[model samples]
Target: MSNSYFQSDLLSEFDRLHQQVASLFGGFPYSVRSDRYGAFPQLNVGSTDDTVEIVAFVPGVQADQLNVSIDKGVLTISGERAPAFGKDEGDESRRYRQERFTGAFRRIIELPAAADPDKVSARYVNGCLTISVGKAEASKPRAITVQ
Candidate 1:
């Protein structure tokens, strides 16, 4: 039946994706971003009374190399993680197997209008990048005094 054929095709496509991802990381990382192809850096996003906090997991990457920016209420995180060990020390290519992604990658997130980019602060520590975006005064919750 047509339904059976459709299911068969879908499964085959799934297998192909698995192989591609396996080759990318040489195997899966402990955590994965199902929506995005390739591995997405592990992350945690939360909000407090004053600001929104974002923490990104990026190991084997230098703190100075990362870039974080907010524009039009959209936060963009981008950076390049060089190979664990570089070439030039010895023969470059011709290795039997290679993995661990190298080069540039980017992730974009849309923030709410309350986010105040001008008051944003960011820091990198323990292989985690943390960004705090303050909320606009008008958007922040305030208590009203009774007359």
Candidate 2:
């Protein structure tokens, strides 16, 4: 019984050391980062006095290929980014490293309390997709009237 207890304690210590080493080396499957929320098309979400704004960093994607929709206070952005290199028969293109994402991606962002789904607009500018959702009139702060 005493030997079993000692073995259990040793196993627990080993497990703690293993976790520490994993964290130091950025966890397992080094391709994924611990800080990122999801795969493809990182986003920035913010809110103003009367509107909520969302910006997605999507390069090499066209406006027509992108889809933006809001349903039940959730905003979804979907799109596909194609590879820059075209197939060449005579000329061979060698690639060493590619960190860019070239595939279909979907990101869903939750709207703030003041955001109104009906009053939403989206546009693609440069390499970014910007979405703006207006707040309801009642949700916006109002100055009280003094008699």
Best by TM-score: 2
TM-score of 2: 0.69
TM-scores of the models, in the order given: 0.67, 0.69
Query: Can you write out model 2's per-residue Cα lDDT over 70-115, one digit (the tens) per residue?
Result: 8877778898988777353344678788777787887766666677
For each candidate in turn, give its C-alpha RMSD to the true structure in angstroms.
Answer: 7.5, 9.6
lDDT for each candidate structure: 0.76, 0.75
lDDT of 2: 0.75
lDDT of 1 by residue, 21-75 (tens): 6667543222212334454465777889899888888888898889998788778
